[model samples]
Target chain A: GESVGLHLPTLSVQEGDNSIINCAYSNSASDYFIWYKQESGKGPQFIIDIRSNMDKRQGQRVTVLLNKTVKHLSLQIAATQPGDSAVYFCAENEGSSNTGKLIFGQGTTLQVKP
Target chain B: GAGVSQSPSNKVTEKGKDVELRCDPISGHTALYWYRQSLGQGLEFLIYFQGNSAPDKSGLPSDRFSAERTGGSVSTLTIQRTQQEDSAVYLCASSSMAGGSYEQYFGPGTRLTVT
Candidate 1:
Protein backbone atom coordinates (compact mmCIF):
# COMPACT_ATOMS: atom_id res chain seq x y z
CA GLY A 1 0.00 0.00 0.00
CA GLU A 2 1.10 3.55 -0.76
CA SER A 3 0.25 6.70 1.17
CA VAL A 4 1.04 10.30 0.36
CA GLY A 5 0.58 12.97 3.05
CA LEU A 6 1.42 16.57 3.65
CA HIS A 7 3.16 18.00 6.69
CA LEU A 8 0.87 21.00 7.03
CA PRO A 9 -2.76 21.41 6.12
CA THR A 10 -2.34 25.12 5.44
CA LEU A 11 0.42 27.65 4.82
CA SER A 12 0.18 31.41 4.98
CA VAL A 13 2.77 33.64 3.39
CA GLN A 14 3.13 37.34 2.77
CA GLU A 15 3.05 38.61 -0.76
CA GLY A 16 6.40 38.45 -2.55
CA ASP A 17 7.61 35.89 -0.03
CA ASN A 18 8.76 32.34 -0.70
CA SER A 19 6.48 29.47 0.27
CA ILE A 20 7.38 25.83 0.67
CA ILE A 21 4.91 22.97 1.00
CA ASN A 22 6.16 19.54 2.10
CA CYS A 23 4.94 16.01 1.52
CA ALA A 24 6.01 12.48 2.46
CA TYR A 25 5.26 9.27 0.64
CA SER A 26 5.44 5.77 2.09
CA ASN A 27 6.05 3.69 -1.02
CA SER A 28 9.61 3.29 -2.12
CA ALA A 29 8.56 1.91 -5.46
CA SER A 30 6.93 5.19 -6.45
CA ASP A 31 9.05 6.66 -9.23
CA TYR A 32 7.25 9.68 -10.65
CA PHE A 33 5.90 12.67 -8.70
CA ILE A 34 3.75 15.61 -9.68
CA TRP A 35 2.63 18.92 -8.17
CA TYR A 36 -0.85 20.27 -8.86
CA LYS A 37 -2.70 23.47 -8.05
CA GLN A 38 -6.48 23.48 -7.59
CA GLU A 39 -8.31 26.76 -7.52
CA SER A 40 -11.83 27.11 -6.26
CA GLY A 41 -14.41 25.47 -8.52
CA LYS A 42 -11.72 24.18 -10.89
CA GLY A 43 -9.87 20.95 -11.46
CA PRO A 44 -6.35 20.32 -10.39
CA GLN A 45 -3.91 21.87 -12.86
CA PHE A 46 -0.53 20.32 -13.52
CA ILE A 47 2.21 22.45 -12.06
CA ILE A 48 5.29 20.28 -12.59
CA ASP A 49 6.56 16.71 -12.41
CA ILE A 50 9.82 14.97 -11.51
CA ARG A 51 11.12 11.49 -12.13
CA SER A 52 12.81 9.42 -9.45
CA ASN A 53 16.08 9.67 -11.32
CA MET A 54 16.09 13.41 -10.83
CA ASP A 55 16.36 15.16 -7.48
CA LYS A 56 14.94 18.50 -8.52
CA ARG A 57 12.98 20.25 -11.27
CA GLN A 58 12.05 23.89 -11.66
CA GLY A 59 9.33 25.75 -13.51
CA GLN A 60 8.81 29.46 -14.11
CA ARG A 61 7.94 30.33 -10.49
CA VAL A 62 7.95 26.97 -8.79
CA THR A 63 10.39 24.19 -7.97
CA VAL A 64 9.89 20.55 -6.96
CA LEU A 65 12.53 18.75 -4.93
CA LEU A 66 12.47 14.99 -4.47
CA ASN A 67 14.33 13.16 -1.76
CA LYS A 68 14.06 9.45 -2.41
CA THR A 69 16.09 8.51 0.63
CA VAL A 70 13.37 9.79 2.95
CA LYS A 71 10.52 9.49 0.47
CA HIS A 72 9.80 13.21 0.63
CA LEU A 73 8.72 15.78 -1.94
CA SER A 74 8.45 19.55 -1.80
CA LEU A 75 7.11 22.44 -3.86
CA GLN A 76 8.59 25.91 -3.57
CA ILE A 77 7.00 29.05 -4.87
CA ALA A 78 8.97 32.25 -5.29
CA ALA A 79 7.55 35.76 -4.92
CA THR A 80 4.11 34.48 -4.15
CA GLN A 81 1.20 36.57 -5.28
CA PRO A 82 -2.48 36.72 -4.39
CA GLY A 83 -3.36 34.65 -7.45
CA ASP A 84 -0.98 31.99 -6.19
CA SER A 85 -3.28 31.27 -3.30
CA ALA A 86 -4.77 27.82 -3.72
CA VAL A 87 -4.67 24.28 -2.47
CA TYR A 88 -1.47 22.50 -3.49
CA PHE A 89 -1.32 18.76 -3.80
CA CYS A 90 1.48 16.29 -4.44
CA ALA A 91 0.86 12.99 -6.18
CA GLU A 92 3.00 9.92 -6.82
CA ASN A 93 2.75 7.26 -9.49
CA GLU A 94 3.10 3.75 -8.08
CA GLY A 95 4.43 2.55 -11.47
CA SER A 96 3.37 -1.05 -10.89
CA SER A 97 0.49 -1.03 -13.38
CA ASN A 98 1.80 1.62 -15.80
CA THR A 99 -1.67 3.05 -16.25
CA GLY A 100 -0.40 6.25 -14.64
CA LYS A 101 -2.81 6.14 -11.71
CA LEU A 102 -1.56 8.60 -9.12
CA ILE A 103 -2.02 8.64 -5.36
CA PHE A 104 -2.61 12.17 -4.13
CA GLY A 105 -1.86 13.74 -0.77
CA GLN A 106 -4.58 15.40 1.26
CA GLY A 107 -3.37 18.87 0.15
CA THR A 108 -1.94 22.04 1.66
CA THR A 109 -3.81 25.30 1.36
CA LEU A 110 -1.42 28.11 0.57
CA GLN A 111 -2.75 31.54 1.41
CA VAL A 112 -0.90 34.54 0.09
CA LYS A 113 -1.45 37.70 2.13
CA PRO A 114 -1.16 41.03 0.41
CA GLY B 1 -7.01 22.11 -28.44
CA ALA B 2 -9.86 21.27 -26.09
CA GLY B 3 -9.20 19.70 -22.72
CA VAL B 4 -11.03 16.82 -21.16
CA SER B 5 -14.73 17.56 -20.64
CA GLN B 6 -17.37 16.11 -18.33
CA SER B 7 -21.12 16.54 -18.76
CA PRO B 8 -23.79 17.49 -16.21
CA SER B 9 -21.44 19.68 -14.27
CA ASN B 10 -23.78 19.43 -11.30
CA LYS B 11 -26.02 16.49 -10.52
CA VAL B 12 -28.52 16.09 -7.71
CA THR B 13 -30.40 12.92 -6.94
CA GLU B 14 -32.25 11.39 -4.05
CA LYS B 15 -30.83 8.52 -2.09
CA GLY B 16 -31.45 5.09 -3.61
CA LYS B 17 -31.44 6.62 -7.08
CA ASP B 18 -28.95 5.82 -9.80
CA VAL B 19 -26.79 8.36 -11.65
CA GLU B 20 -24.45 8.31 -14.59
CA LEU B 21 -21.65 10.76 -15.22
CA ARG B 22 -20.00 11.26 -18.56
CA CYS B 23 -16.47 12.12 -19.60
CA ASP B 24 -15.07 13.00 -22.99
CA PRO B 25 -11.33 12.63 -23.18
CA ILE B 26 -9.10 14.69 -25.38
CA SER B 27 -8.84 13.58 -28.97
CA GLY B 28 -6.25 10.83 -29.50
CA HIS B 29 -5.73 10.20 -25.80
CA THR B 30 -5.27 6.52 -25.01
CA ALA B 31 -5.70 6.58 -21.27
CA LEU B 32 -8.69 7.78 -19.22
CA TYR B 33 -9.11 7.80 -15.47
CA TRP B 34 -11.94 8.52 -13.04
CA TYR B 35 -11.39 9.91 -9.56
CA ARG B 36 -13.59 11.03 -6.69
CA GLN B 37 -12.87 14.01 -4.48
CA SER B 38 -14.71 14.50 -1.25
CA LEU B 39 -14.96 17.87 0.38
CA GLY B 40 -11.56 18.96 1.71
CA GLN B 41 -10.05 15.62 0.72
CA GLY B 42 -7.73 14.38 -1.97
CA LEU B 43 -8.57 12.58 -5.18
CA GLU B 44 -9.48 8.92 -4.88
CA PHE B 45 -8.83 6.62 -7.82
CA LEU B 46 -11.97 5.01 -9.19
CA ILE B 47 -11.36 3.28 -12.52
CA TYR B 48 -8.90 3.42 -15.39
CA PHE B 49 -9.24 2.77 -19.11
CA GLN B 50 -6.49 2.22 -21.63
CA GLY B 51 -7.16 1.79 -25.28
CA ASN B 52 -9.43 -1.15 -26.08
CA SER B 53 -7.99 -3.42 -23.43
CA ALA B 54 -9.90 -4.55 -20.36
CA PRO B 55 -10.16 -1.68 -17.89
CA ASP B 56 -8.49 -1.71 -14.49
CA LYS B 57 -11.32 -1.46 -12.01
CA SER B 58 -9.23 -2.20 -8.97
CA GLY B 59 -10.00 1.21 -7.49
CA LEU B 60 -13.79 1.04 -7.61
CA PRO B 61 -14.85 1.36 -3.96
CA SER B 62 -17.78 -1.04 -4.09
CA ASP B 63 -19.84 -3.33 -6.27
CA ARG B 64 -22.40 -0.59 -6.69
CA PHE B 65 -19.93 1.40 -8.77
CA SER B 66 -19.19 0.64 -12.40
CA ALA B 67 -17.78 2.39 -15.45
CA GLU B 68 -17.33 1.76 -19.17
CA ARG B 69 -15.36 3.28 -21.98
CA THR B 70 -17.02 3.21 -25.39
CA GLY B 71 -15.19 3.28 -28.72
CA GLY B 72 -12.04 4.31 -26.83
CA SER B 73 -13.23 7.87 -26.45
CA VAL B 74 -16.15 8.54 -24.14
CA SER B 75 -16.69 7.02 -20.71
CA THR B 76 -19.62 6.67 -18.35
CA LEU B 77 -19.51 6.05 -14.62
CA THR B 78 -22.67 4.73 -13.05
CA ILE B 79 -23.47 4.52 -9.40
CA GLN B 80 -26.37 2.42 -8.17
CA ARG B 81 -28.41 3.18 -5.06
CA THR B 82 -26.45 6.24 -4.27
CA GLN B 83 -25.96 7.18 -0.65
CA GLN B 84 -25.29 10.48 1.02
CA GLU B 85 -21.71 9.36 1.37
CA ASP B 86 -21.55 9.14 -2.42
CA SER B 87 -21.70 12.90 -2.78
CA ALA B 88 -18.48 14.21 -4.23
CA VAL B 89 -16.85 15.77 -7.26
CA TYR B 90 -16.13 13.24 -9.97
CA LEU B 91 -13.09 14.16 -11.99
CA CYS B 92 -12.01 12.66 -15.29
CA ALA B 93 -8.55 12.85 -16.73
CA SER B 94 -6.91 11.65 -19.94
CA SER B 95 -3.41 11.32 -21.25
CA SER B 96 -1.64 10.19 -24.36
CA MET B 97 0.76 7.23 -24.11
CA ALA B 98 3.62 9.22 -25.51
CA GLY B 99 6.93 8.10 -23.97
CA GLY B 100 4.92 6.10 -21.43
CA SER B 101 4.54 8.88 -18.83
CA TYR B 102 2.35 11.62 -20.16
CA GLU B 103 0.76 14.33 -18.02
CA GLN B 104 -2.96 13.92 -17.44
CA TYR B 105 -5.34 16.72 -18.41
CA PHE B 106 -8.36 17.00 -16.12
CA GLY B 107 -11.92 18.08 -16.72
CA PRO B 108 -13.99 20.59 -14.74
CA GLY B 109 -15.64 17.63 -12.99
CA THR B 110 -19.21 16.62 -12.23
CA ARG B 111 -20.50 17.39 -8.75
CA LEU B 112 -22.83 14.63 -7.58
CA THR B 113 -25.05 15.28 -4.61
CA VAL B 114 -27.32 12.64 -3.17
CA THR B 115 -30.09 14.06 -1.01
Candidate 2:
Protein backbone atom coordinates (compact mmCIF):
# COMPACT_ATOMS: atom_id res chain seq x y z
CA GLY A 1 0.00 0.00 0.00
CA GLU A 2 1.15 3.57 -0.80
CA SER A 3 -0.01 7.11 -0.01
CA VAL A 4 -0.68 9.87 -2.45
CA GLY A 5 2.08 12.43 -3.22
CA LEU A 6 4.60 10.72 -1.00
CA HIS A 7 8.11 9.41 -1.51
CA LEU A 8 8.59 6.28 -3.56
CA PRO A 9 7.91 2.91 -1.95
CA THR A 10 9.79 -0.26 -2.94
CA LEU A 11 8.70 -3.79 -3.81
CA SER A 12 11.05 -6.77 -3.74
CA VAL A 13 10.11 -10.09 -5.28
CA GLN A 14 11.91 -13.26 -6.17
CA GLU A 15 12.70 -14.06 -9.73
CA GLY A 16 9.99 -15.92 -11.63
CA ASP A 17 7.41 -14.54 -9.23
CA ASN A 18 4.95 -11.84 -10.07
CA SER A 19 5.39 -8.33 -8.65
CA ILE A 20 2.73 -5.75 -7.99
CA ILE A 21 3.48 -2.03 -7.65
CA ASN A 22 0.78 0.32 -6.48
CA CYS A 23 0.20 4.03 -6.95
CA ALA A 24 -2.48 6.41 -5.67
CA TYR A 25 -3.10 9.36 -7.88
CA SER A 26 -4.54 12.69 -6.68
CA ASN A 27 -6.74 13.92 -9.48
CA SER A 28 -10.31 12.81 -10.11
CA ALA A 29 -10.47 14.45 -13.50
CA SER A 30 -7.66 12.35 -14.91
CA ASP A 31 -8.99 10.29 -17.80
CA TYR A 32 -5.77 8.55 -18.78
CA PHE A 33 -2.99 6.76 -16.93
CA ILE A 34 0.43 5.55 -17.97
CA TRP A 35 3.03 3.21 -16.49
CA TYR A 36 6.74 3.71 -17.07
CA LYS A 37 9.90 1.81 -16.20
CA GLN A 38 13.25 3.47 -15.59
CA GLU A 39 16.60 1.77 -15.19
CA SER A 40 19.41 3.25 -13.12
CA GLY A 41 20.72 6.47 -14.67
CA LYS A 42 18.19 6.32 -17.48
CA GLY A 43 14.94 8.11 -18.18
CA PRO A 44 11.56 6.47 -17.80
CA GLN A 45 10.47 4.17 -20.60
CA PHE A 46 6.79 3.69 -21.30
CA ILE A 47 5.58 0.24 -20.31
CA ILE A 48 1.79 0.25 -20.69
CA ASP A 49 -1.13 2.67 -20.61
CA ILE A 50 -4.85 2.51 -19.96
CA ARG A 51 -7.67 4.95 -20.55
CA SER A 52 -10.28 5.70 -17.91
CA ASN A 53 -12.83 3.80 -19.95
CA MET A 54 -10.98 0.52 -19.28
CA ASP A 55 -10.32 -0.97 -15.88
CA LYS A 56 -7.47 -3.17 -17.09
CA ARG A 57 -5.07 -3.49 -20.00
CA GLN A 58 -2.47 -6.14 -20.75
CA GLY A 59 0.75 -6.01 -22.66
CA GLN A 60 3.67 -8.37 -23.12
CA ARG A 61 4.30 -9.74 -19.64
CA VAL A 62 2.81 -6.61 -18.06
CA THR A 63 -0.66 -5.65 -16.87
CA VAL A 64 -2.08 -2.36 -15.59
CA LEU A 65 -5.14 -2.19 -13.36
CA LEU A 66 -6.90 1.07 -12.59
CA ASN A 67 -9.39 1.74 -9.82
CA LYS A 68 -11.05 5.05 -10.34
CA THR A 69 -13.03 4.90 -7.16
CA VAL A 70 -9.96 4.85 -4.95
CA LYS A 71 -7.72 6.61 -7.42
CA HIS A 72 -5.39 3.66 -7.22
CA LEU A 73 -3.43 2.07 -10.06
CA SER A 74 -1.31 -1.02 -10.07
CA LEU A 75 1.25 -2.56 -12.39
CA GLN A 76 1.66 -6.31 -12.33
CA ILE A 77 4.66 -7.94 -13.92
CA ALA A 78 4.39 -11.62 -14.71
CA ALA A 79 7.39 -13.86 -13.97
CA THR A 80 9.59 -11.03 -12.96
CA GLN A 81 13.27 -11.20 -13.91
CA PRO A 82 16.42 -9.31 -12.98
CA GLY A 83 16.17 -7.35 -16.19
CA ASP A 84 12.72 -6.23 -15.14
CA SER A 85 14.01 -4.49 -12.02
CA ALA A 86 13.46 -0.77 -12.26
CA VAL A 87 11.58 2.20 -10.87
CA TYR A 88 7.95 2.04 -11.92
CA PHE A 89 5.99 5.29 -12.27
CA CYS A 90 2.30 5.97 -12.77
CA ALA A 91 1.37 9.25 -14.42
CA GLU A 92 -1.97 10.97 -14.88
CA ASN A 93 -2.98 13.18 -17.75
CA GLU A 94 -4.55 16.23 -16.13
CA GLY A 95 -4.85 18.11 -19.38
CA SER A 96 -8.44 18.68 -20.34
CA SER A 97 -7.68 19.15 -24.00
CA ASN A 98 -5.21 17.43 -26.33
CA THR A 99 -2.11 18.64 -24.48
CA GLY A 100 0.13 15.94 -23.06
CA LYS A 101 1.01 17.53 -19.74
CA LEU A 102 1.14 14.90 -16.99
CA ILE A 103 1.25 14.76 -13.22
CA PHE A 104 3.35 11.87 -11.97
CA GLY A 105 2.94 9.99 -8.73
CA GLN A 106 5.73 8.82 -6.48
CA GLY A 107 7.34 5.79 -8.15
CA THR A 108 7.88 2.31 -6.80
CA THR A 109 11.26 0.65 -7.06
CA LEU A 110 10.85 -2.97 -8.08
CA GLN A 111 13.77 -5.17 -7.12
CA VAL A 112 13.94 -8.71 -8.49
CA LYS A 113 15.90 -11.19 -6.44
CA PRO A 114 17.57 -14.09 -8.12
CA GLY B 1 13.69 6.05 -36.30
CA ALA B 2 15.53 7.97 -33.59
CA GLY B 3 14.15 8.43 -30.10
CA VAL B 4 14.29 11.58 -27.99
CA SER B 5 17.83 12.83 -27.31
CA GLN B 6 19.22 15.22 -24.65
CA SER B 7 22.55 17.00 -24.61
CA PRO B 8 25.21 17.50 -21.93
CA SER B 9 24.28 14.34 -20.15
CA ASN B 10 25.97 15.82 -17.08
CA LYS B 11 26.38 19.37 -15.87
CA VAL B 12 28.17 20.98 -12.92
CA THR B 13 27.51 24.65 -12.31
CA GLU B 14 28.20 27.02 -9.49
CA LYS B 15 25.33 28.52 -7.54
CA GLY B 16 23.94 31.70 -9.08
CA LYS B 17 25.23 30.67 -12.50
CA ASP B 18 22.83 29.88 -15.31
CA VAL B 19 22.57 26.56 -17.14
CA GLU B 20 20.85 25.47 -20.30
CA LEU B 21 19.71 21.95 -21.19
CA ARG B 22 18.62 20.86 -24.62
CA CYS B 23 16.26 18.21 -25.91
CA ASP B 24 15.77 16.90 -29.43
CA PRO B 25 12.45 15.21 -29.75
CA ILE B 26 11.62 12.32 -32.03
CA SER B 27 11.31 13.15 -35.70
CA GLY B 28 8.08 14.97 -36.51
CA HIS B 29 6.80 14.73 -32.95
CA THR B 30 4.57 17.64 -32.13
CA ALA B 31 4.66 17.47 -28.35
CA LEU B 32 7.67 17.97 -26.06
CA TYR B 33 7.95 18.12 -22.27
CA TRP B 34 10.44 18.86 -19.49
CA TYR B 35 10.47 17.25 -16.06
CA ARG B 36 12.77 17.37 -13.04
CA GLN B 37 13.51 14.49 -10.71
CA SER B 38 15.33 15.14 -7.48
CA LEU B 39 17.24 12.35 -5.84
CA GLY B 40 14.88 9.69 -4.55
CA GLN B 41 11.93 11.74 -5.76
CA GLY B 42 9.40 11.32 -8.51
CA LEU B 43 9.33 13.30 -11.71
CA GLU B 44 8.05 16.90 -11.44
CA PHE B 45 6.33 18.38 -14.45
CA LEU B 46 8.01 21.60 -15.55
CA ILE B 47 6.66 22.64 -18.90
CA TYR B 48 5.15 21.33 -22.13
CA PHE B 49 5.09 22.39 -25.76
CA GLN B 50 2.66 21.41 -28.48
CA GLY B 51 3.57 22.27 -32.04
CA ASN B 52 3.40 26.05 -32.67
CA SER B 53 0.85 26.70 -29.94
CA ALA B 54 1.80 28.61 -26.82
CA PRO B 55 3.57 26.37 -24.32
CA ASP B 56 2.12 25.55 -20.93
CA LYS B 57 4.35 27.22 -18.38
CA SER B 58 2.08 26.63 -15.45
CA GLY B 59 4.38 23.97 -14.01
CA LEU B 60 7.42 26.20 -13.85
CA PRO B 61 8.63 26.62 -10.31
CA SER B 62 9.55 30.27 -10.48
CA ASP B 63 10.27 33.25 -12.67
CA ARG B 64 13.88 32.14 -12.99
CA PHE B 65 12.88 29.01 -14.86
CA SER B 66 12.02 29.29 -18.54
CA ALA B 67 12.00 27.18 -21.70
CA GLU B 68 11.60 27.61 -25.43
CA ARG B 69 11.04 25.36 -28.43
CA THR B 70 12.48 26.64 -31.68
CA GLY B 71 10.95 25.85 -35.08
CA GLY B 72 8.82 23.14 -33.42
CA SER B 73 11.80 20.77 -33.36
CA VAL B 74 14.25 21.26 -30.50
CA SER B 75 13.59 22.63 -27.01
CA THR B 76 15.79 24.29 -24.39
CA LEU B 77 15.15 24.57 -20.66
CA THR B 78 17.03 27.37 -18.96
CA ILE B 79 17.43 27.88 -15.26
CA GLN B 80 18.62 31.35 -14.42
CA ARG B 81 20.36 32.14 -11.13
CA THR B 82 20.53 28.48 -10.38
CA GLN B 83 20.38 27.40 -6.78
CA GLN B 84 21.58 24.31 -4.98
CA GLU B 85 18.02 23.07 -4.95
CA ASP B 86 18.15 23.06 -8.72
CA SER B 87 20.36 20.00 -8.66
CA ALA B 88 18.42 17.19 -10.21
CA VAL B 89 18.09 15.04 -13.30
CA TYR B 90 16.22 16.90 -15.99
CA LEU B 91 14.30 14.64 -18.31
CA CYS B 92 12.84 15.41 -21.71
CA ALA B 93 10.13 13.53 -23.54
CA SER B 94 8.25 13.82 -26.80
CA SER B 95 5.00 12.44 -28.10
CA SER B 96 4.09 11.70 -31.69
CA MET B 97 0.97 13.74 -31.22
CA ALA B 98 -0.07 16.61 -28.95
CA GLY B 99 -2.67 14.61 -27.10
CA GLY B 100 -2.57 12.74 -23.82
CA SER B 101 -3.51 9.42 -25.39
CA TYR B 102 -0.23 9.24 -27.32
CA GLU B 103 2.91 7.71 -25.83
CA GLN B 104 5.83 9.92 -24.91
CA TYR B 105 9.38 8.84 -25.74
CA PHE B 106 12.01 9.99 -23.21
CA GLY B 107 15.69 10.84 -23.40
CA PRO B 108 18.45 9.72 -21.04
CA GLY B 109 18.22 13.07 -19.21
CA THR B 110 20.75 15.63 -18.01
CA ARG B 111 22.07 15.46 -14.48
CA LEU B 112 22.57 18.98 -13.16
CA THR B 113 24.63 19.58 -10.06
CA VAL B 114 24.63 23.08 -8.66
CA THR B 115 27.20 23.68 -5.99
Q: Quick one: best lDDT, which candidate?
A: 1
RMSD of each: 0.9, 2.5
What is the C-alpha lDDT profile of model 1 across A8-103, one tens digit per residue?
A: 999999999999999999999888899999998899999999999999999999999999999999999999999999999999886555778888
Complex DockQ per candidate: 0.79, 0.74
Distance from true location, Cα of A3 in model 2, Å: 9.7
Error of 2 at A58 (Å): 0.7
Candidate-wise lDDT, in order? 0.94, 0.88
Clashing pairs in 1: none
Candidate 2 residue runs with Cα over 4 Å from true position: A1-8, B98-100
Where in model 1 is the C-alpha error above 4 Å?
none
Top DockQ prediction, candidate number = 1
| Standalone chain B TM-score for every prediction | 0.98, 0.96
Q: Number of clashes in every candidate structure?
A: 0, 0
lDDT of each residue in B46-111, candidate 2, tens digit only: 999988889999889999999999999999999999999999999999997645456788999999
